[model samples]
Target chain A: MGATPTAAVLDAGNLQQLLDILQKQNYQTVGPTVRDNAVVYEHIQSVEDLPRGWTDEQTNGRYRLTHGKGKKFFGYVHGPNSWKKFLYPPARQLYAADRMKHRFDVVAPEPSGIKPALIGVRACELAAIMVQDRVLMDGEYIDPEYKARRQNAVIVAVNCTRAGGTCFCASMNTGPRVQEGYDILLTEVVDSHGHYFTVETASEKGRAIAAQLATSPASEEQLAAARQAVDKAARQMGRTLDLTDLKDSLYRGFDSIHWEKVAGRCLTCGNCTMVCPTCFCVNVEDTTALTGEQAFRIRRWDSCFTVDFSYIHGGSIRATDYSRYRQWLLHKLAYWQDQFGVVGCVGCGRCITWCPVGIDITEEARAVKG
Target chain B: MASKKKPTLAVWKFASCDGCQLSLLDCEDELLAVADVVQIANFPEASRAVKRGPYDISLVEGSITTPHDAERIHKIRRMSKTLVVIGACATAGGIQALRNFTDVRRYVSAVYAHPEYIETLNKSTPIADHVFVDFELRGCPINKYHLIEVINAYLNGRKPNIPSYSVCMECKRKGNVCVMVATGVPCLGPVTQAGCGAICPSFNRGCYSCFGPKETPNTEALAGWLHALDQRPDEIVRAFRGFNAYAEPFRKQSEAYEK
Candidate 1:
C-alpha cells in the first residue's frame, strides 16, 4: 500500500475470462488442481482442470477435502505443493560427459526455456519465493537455470478466504489476503445465493491483461464481498501461535525437558521438511553404473530428523532425537530472528498439516515457552 | 602399462545408515566430473572399480562401532591423504548414539541373532577419534552444496566457507518464522550448526540439533526455557544427549540433568 500500487478487481467470471486471455497471450496458465490426494499447483490449458467443486476442512495441523458448495476456481489453502517444484525443479541435470579415447570433455547443461503463469499464488508462498530469489538469483553465484525460470514467470495472487487449520498467517502477518508481489489478486465470494470471484490487478502486466480482456471495474459491493471473504478466512484459522517473549525462552531453554518429550514421539521421519514449501535442505549424490562407463550427479531432499543429517568428522554434534528436535525448533524460532532480521516462516502451515505424527508447532512452542 | 595419474577418491563405510556417503554420490551433476578429476578408488556402493586406497581423498561414512572399525580407520588414515567423515554415524555415532545411555551389550543380546559372535564397544565413536581428519563437514547428512564447497575448497587450497554458527543463522537468512518464539515450539536451533540451512524451521518446525552444537552456543539459557515449559529434568538431560552426545557441550548438558 505504501510504494506498491493499490488493489484492483475483476468480476466473478473474470477467472475463466482471465484464462482465455492468457491462452490468447501465449502464457501457460498454472494454478491449484486436485492431484494425488492433496491439492497441488499444476498447468491448466482450460477452466475444466480447475478443482471446480472442492473445498478443504482444516484443524490444528490437519486438513481434508470437504464438498464444494458450488463451482469455484480458487478455494483452498497453500497445498501440499507450492510454486517451488516448477521454479526450482527437484532434480536437474547439471552436465553430461563422454569418455572418448582416454580423453574427456564435460558439457554444461543447456537452459530449457519454460515460461509459466502462476495463478492462485498465496501471500506466504510469494514471500517464500522472494526468499529463494534472494538466495538463488541475487547472490553472486546465481543459478542460471533458476534465473531463467523465475524471470519468465507471471504472478496471480489469491486473497485467502479460507485459512487452513494449521495456518497462522495472521500471527506471521503473511496472509489471509494477498498483500503484494503479484500481477493480479482475487477474492472469491460465495454465499447462500451464488458465487463470484472479485479480481484485482496490481502490476503493469496485470493491467494489460485486464485491459485486453472484457471486464468491469470491481463494484463497491464486490469489494465488500472480497473483504468479507478474506475476513471469514482469517477467522477460520484452526490454530494460533503465540510469539510473545519467544527470543528469551529460546535463548534460556538450552537444556529443556520438553525436547525429550518431543524426541520420544518424533519418528525423525523428515516428512515435515519434504512436504514443506520452504524447506530447502538437499543432499547430493553421484549415480554411477558397474562399468564406471557413465555417471550423473544428483541432489535430493534431506532432513535433520535422520541421525545422518548432522554428522561431523569427529562425530555428529547432536546425537539424540532430543537435541536434534531442539536444534530444529530453536533455529526456527529464536536463532532465525537473531540472524536474518526476519522471522523464518510465513505461517503457511504446510509443515503442521503434513507431519505424519501430527505434531503441532503451537504445542511445542508452548512447551518450550511456558 | 599406462601410468596411474588420477587422484583416487575412495568412499568408505562405518556404522552409519549410508546416507552421508550417499550424499557424495547424490551429487548427480558433479559425480562424473568429480570422477573424471579423481579415480574411483574403493566405493562398494557405486561401482566394482575398487582400486585400493593410498587415495587422494577418502570420504568415510558411518561410525566406529567395533574394534575392527577402530583398527581399520587407522589403516584408512595411512592409505588416505585426506579423510573426510560423512553423516551422523561417522561424525558422532549416529542414532545408535542413543545406545550410549543404556547398556550396549544387553541391547545387542536383546535384539541381535547372536550376541556371542557380535563384538562391539561400550561406546560408538567417530572416525576422527580413530584418525586425523583433513576436514569434518557437518550435517545429519551433509548438505550437498556444502559438500561441494568443501571439495572445491580442498581443490583451491583454502578453508571451506562452512559456517560454525548455529541453525539460527540459516533460519534468519531464509526468513523462516521462528518455530520457538513465534509458535512457542521447542527447538535446538540455538546450539546446532548451520550446514542444514535451517530446514526444519523452513517447514515451520523447530530445529533439532541435527548439525550439533555451535561455537560457544548459549544452550544453558534455552534449556532453562524448556524446563519452564513443565518438562522434567531427566528429559532435559536427554535433550543434550542426542546424535552428538559424545560431543562436548551437549554431553555436559545432558550429564547435568543426571546430577
Candidate 2:
C-alpha cells in the first residue's frame, strides 16, 4: 500500500522506537528475557528487557547460558518456550458447568483479550507456527481459542547469524534466513559501520511501523553483510538430517531393529515432544466441586509417548517403550507428511538438545534411513 | 432422579510412606468441594468416623509387603465397586519394593536388633499384582489434579485421561532444556511414566523415575546411554532400583545389569 515494502537500515539505538510503535498500537509486546538460566519469552516493556549479550550453548541433553561477544540480542537459538505457550497455552479451561438438580448448564470460557506483538521470532519457529496453523486452524475443526490469539497477534522475525550446537534449521531449510511469515524481518549486523539492523517489511502494517522509525535506505554493503551473516549461520549448523526420501525411509524403517536399539537408551520420557515446537497433542479433563454444584472441563498438552495417549477400551495400543518411541519419531518424520502434507520437524533440534538421555533425532533418522 | 444417592468413597493404606494419602488431604481448597459430592465412607487419616464399605470408589495407597496386608487387600477389593490405586507404592510397589531384589530377612536383621520381632513378606508387590485394579495413578506422591480427574472419570462413567508417557514430555512442555544432552547428566525420564510434571528435570537434575515405567519402557537403551556417559553398570542398576524397583520393566532392566 505504501511504496511496496523496501529494505532500510536502522541503528540499534532506535530499536526501542520500533517497539514503542507496536506498544502505541495497543499490542502487548512479548519478547525474550533472561529467566531461570535460559532465554524465555515474557511480557517485555522495553528494549532493555531483551536478553542482550546473552547467548546459549546447547547440545544433546544439555544447555548452558553464556555471554555473547557483543551487545547482540537474539543471538541464542530456540529455548524451551515456543510462541505456542502464548497461543495454545499449557493449560486452559475449555468450559464450566453449573450442576443443577436435573440437568447441567455449560458455559464456555471467554477468549483471551490480549493482542501480543511477538518480537525476535526465529525462522524455524515461524515454520513451526505455520505447521501448527495447518494442524490447528486449517483443519475442519478449527481451534477457536488458538484462532483468536493468532489473529490478533503481530510477528517480528529475527534472521539467525549464529547456530547452536543442536541447530539443524539449515538442513530443514527453515532458517538462517527468513523468507516469509513475518510482519517485519530484522537482520542484526555488527561491524565498523556500527551495530544496526537491516529491516525489511513483509506487510503493509510492517511498512507503516517502519515508516515511523528513524531509518535510511540500506546500502549494497549493508545488505551483503546481512546475507553473509545468514550464510555463516547455515555453515555453522551442528546437526543435519538428510531429508532425501526421509519420510519413506522412516516408514520403511518401522521394523528396522534400530527402534529397539534407540529404545534401549530411551527412558520413554516425553521430553522431546514437550520441547518440540510442532508437537501438539492434548488431553481433556473434567473436574467437579465436592458439592457437585460446579464442574470444569480443562484441556492440557498431551504427548504420544504417554501410555494413556493410546489407551483403548481394553488396555493400550502402544504398550511397549520401543513402540511408543517409534510412534512419536515416525509421526514427526513420516506420518505427519501423510496427514499434514509437511514434515512435523522444522529441524530446530530442541528435541535433540533437550532429551534427558541425549537421544539425537537426526542420528536416529540417519540410522533408520541407512 | 430426585432421590439420587451420593457415591461413597474410601481410602486405604499399606506398606509405604503416607505421602500419597496426604496428597488427597493436601487438596485444601478442593477438599470441601470433593467432600460435598461423595460420602467419606472410610479414611483413617482424614476422619476418625469410619463408615462401613461397599464403597462406590476406593482409593488405595501403598503396596503389599506383609501377609496381613496381602490378605486384607482381597477383602477391600470385594467391598469396592471401583478400586483405584494411587502412587508408586500402590501401582508399582514403591521404594519399599527394593526388598523384591534382596532378602527381606537380611534387611530386617540389618535394621532391627531382634529380627524375630518383625514379620514381613518375601516381596513388596503392587495392588494390581494381587487383584484387578480399575485404574492406577503413578508418581512418588500422586498429583492432586490427576487424583481429582480419576475420581471424576469414575463417577462420570468415562475413561480416565491420565497419560502413560515419559517425563520427557513434561520437561519439554515446561521449556526446560535437557539436562542429559546439555550437561551429560543421566535421567530416567525417558523410560519413566508421566504424571509428576517432569519436576526433577525442571530443577536441572535427571528424572529419578518416581512415577515408575511408562506403558512400555526401553530401559536397556537408557542404560546403554548411561554406560556411554561413563556410568558403571552397577550405578545404572541402582538407578532403576529406586522407587519402583518391583515394576516389571525396571526390575528386568536392573536384573539384566546386575553382576
Top model number, DockQ: 2
**Model 2, span A29-104: residue lDDT tens:** 9999987677888889999999999999888777888886779877777676788888888889999999877999
User: In DockQ, how does model 1 score against the reference complex?
Assistant: 0.04
Model 2: residues with Cα > 4 Å off, grouped in runs: A1-4, A97-105, A243-257, A286-296, A311-330, B110-113
Model 2 scores a C-alpha lDDT of 0.85
Q: What tens-digit string does per-residue lDDT give for candidate 1 at A90-200?
A: 667676555557876676787678777898888888877776676678767787888898887788777887777688888777777777778877777775435666666
Instruction: Score residue B206 of candidate 1 by CA lDDT.
Output: 73
CA lDDT of each prediction against the hidden true structure: 0.71, 0.85
- Cα error of candidate 1 at position B163, Å: 25
Model 1: lDDT of residue A75: 73
Docking class of 1: incorrect
TM-score of each: 0.59, 0.89
